[model samples]
Target: MNGYRFYTAASLLLLTALFTACQKSAPAPQEESGVNAETEIIPEPNAGSEKPQLTVAISVDIAPYVMKNATTGIEVDIATQALPGYQLNFIQLPYEKLQSAVAQDQADMALGVQKFKDVEGIFYSENFIDFVNAAITKKSANLKIEKVADLADHKVLTWQDAYLELGPEFEKLFAPDSPQRKNYVEVADQSEQVQQFWDAKDVVIVIDRSIFNAISQAKGHKLSEVDYASIFPEATYFKANFEEADVRDAFNAGLKKLCSSGEYAKLLKKYNIELPNTICDSKAHP
Candidate 1:
């Protein structure tokens, strides 16, 4: 009887061990396993990964190159067509503030910088456009101001923040006694100055030729010609940060393609701008 009981206990122990082994060997239930079990190995979500975005900055004041149309508050059709991959954001800053904005990373690029040497930590592409500076006054004033130095006794108005070298020239000719040669009243913007000149015939307004022409055409104002041409020889460019070499390269490639294909000429014509041959000769033509 004792031998039989020991055999029964050993047999029961062996059976329990086998049952535990079978449980351990059983396959786990996979939540994703279905008709297509191969697709169960899905990739894990990566929170750190993201697509890179390119940003470009431009000024809002330079007409034709940049301007706020009555229909569209801000127009960037040229840039949009040029840099299709970039996400463009115009900062609408003043000319003086544009350089600082790009340097401080507030903007990735600045458009309409005529001279590359003037800005630091920024790389400029080839010149796209040229501008001519001119003086405007009422038709009745009939001001015969020829050279920049000729506006000595007359009250002149120009953009306040602009670097108007002509002001100093006028001061040297007129107000030698006054410190800083206080010659004319500087206003915040060209439009304001032009309006001032319009209201007060005594004041003379100095502005860019393209702007003067557009304004005159739009408002039916008469623009008189000065003897001297204020055409700047340097061409304007799309300025990018020094670190953004790739973006600059892409833009240059696109611009070169556009120039070669005569697309640039089409753009100029679309804006009603006439390109002068003097731009290629490094000389200013009237």
Candidate 2:
């Protein structure tokens, strides 16, 4: 009778041990978060992403074009989209400092660089952006401006350097030597230009459409009541200047790719910007 009781107790102990062992050896319950799943592959942050940093110089004055935020706007975005292989770090300086920064090696590249006659020691990329200048007038004015010459009939307002920029025909007509030169005013401040245009209903402003819209709309001006005439040629191309020729070539290639893939147009619309002329409009390779 004692052996039988002892055997019963021993069997119970053995069975409990076996049950605990089985439970311990069983596969872990599936995690609700799926972290332990066999198929889940989570990438480590910054894994194998050792891209070189490219310091780009940009204008601080041009709002909506410069560094509007930490990682957006026309100048910052254009460089970011154009150079995917390298990380871009933009240094916002004044308009005059853009070229000097690159020239002095303060930045690796500069946006909105133009190849001036006397400017040297810079590698310019293919014409990447067009400023899209136009002859703006009031919609109710009924102005017939099919060409640059027609602007002679009305008061013209333009940027300070418009004479050298708006082609020889414009230079001949309104830039200089016109008896109406007093009526054709060129001011350095474009914000003033927009104000002046709206202040005088008959005034025709020679300005970039995007810039005009940017300034005008910000000042609570209604665009539906405005009219623009694109008389200027799309020759003035915007380029990125680089310290190295190789980098310039790389940027050109990337720009071409963006245009081909149609991402360039999408970016333009994202910023509510457009090309001055219909010739390329961020589509052409050149």
Candidate 3:
């Protein structure tokens, strides 16, 4: 009986020691990873609210900005990083359809929109990037576009809906009743616009500055041989219209965070996109 009691006490002591050791051996909670912490999300709108997945509308087939083959682009990267809490649903469509997606309540935000002026039930976040536009001509043509009116005498090729996207001033200049409308052609494909310009079908092609540079580099256009008329002012791109104001506000907050954290610069580097002076200027205050 005494031996049995001794064994029981010894076993209890052993169990106690094991419990104490386990308490000491267990790991404390580890700090969140830098990337995870950096991307730490704020819950959507109201607490305990179950928000539907966010739909982000982007124009399809816009390379480097909205890639045709790849799932990611500059705007996609920014959106993904900025809105970490919501399950992003990208609805890729044509330029016109993209805006309609938001209007029809089919999308939460429209990516890469220049402006939403005069659009009802639509709001836009702070401008995140600038779309520098220009008029390009072949060296042989020597066509000069000193201003919007200068393009009246020359055949001009530009992306679809450019008249509306370029702002009210451009709208008036490219109005249906305006004589410039006779020579004005809005193409659906940017590649075709660049090709048409290179083929010398038009006197001038209106395109985004960075896009023109990329196409020019690929086609082996000599920098000295091509003239880019810096006529149009830069257009500011923004996240336009979400179902809820809080959602848009959250994105604005996240965008500011992204800019301040230098993640915006990193994204531009990753995509090989040149940082425009407009964006660079925004970084100063961010």
The TM-scores, one per candidate, come to 0.64, 0.67, 0.73
Error of 1 at 167 (Å): 11
- What is the TM-score (0 to 1) of candidate 2? 0.67
Per residue, candidate 3 scores C-alpha lDDT tens digits across 62-175 of 556766532787778888788888878787877767666777877878876655465777776767666768888877776666888787788889988788766577788888
Clash statistics: count for each candidate: 0, 1, 0
Q: Which stretches of candidate 2 lie over 4 Å from their true place?
A: 1-51, 61-64, 67-71, 93-101, 104-106, 118-120, 140-144, 174-181, 274-286
Cα lDDT tens digits for candidate 1, 80-132: 55566765656666655665666778767666544435555566665444555
TM-score-superior candidate, 1 or 3 = 3
Quick one: how many clashes does candidate 2 have? 1
Collision pairs in model 3: none
Error of 1 at 12 (Å): 34
Per-residue CA lDDT of candidate 2, range 2-60, in tens?
99999999999999999999999999867767465566686777856788888888765
The C-alpha RMSD of each candidate to the native structure, in angstroms, is: 7.2, 8.9, 11.9
| Model number with the top TM-score | 3
> Between the candidate structures 2 and 3, which one is better when assessed by lDDT?
2
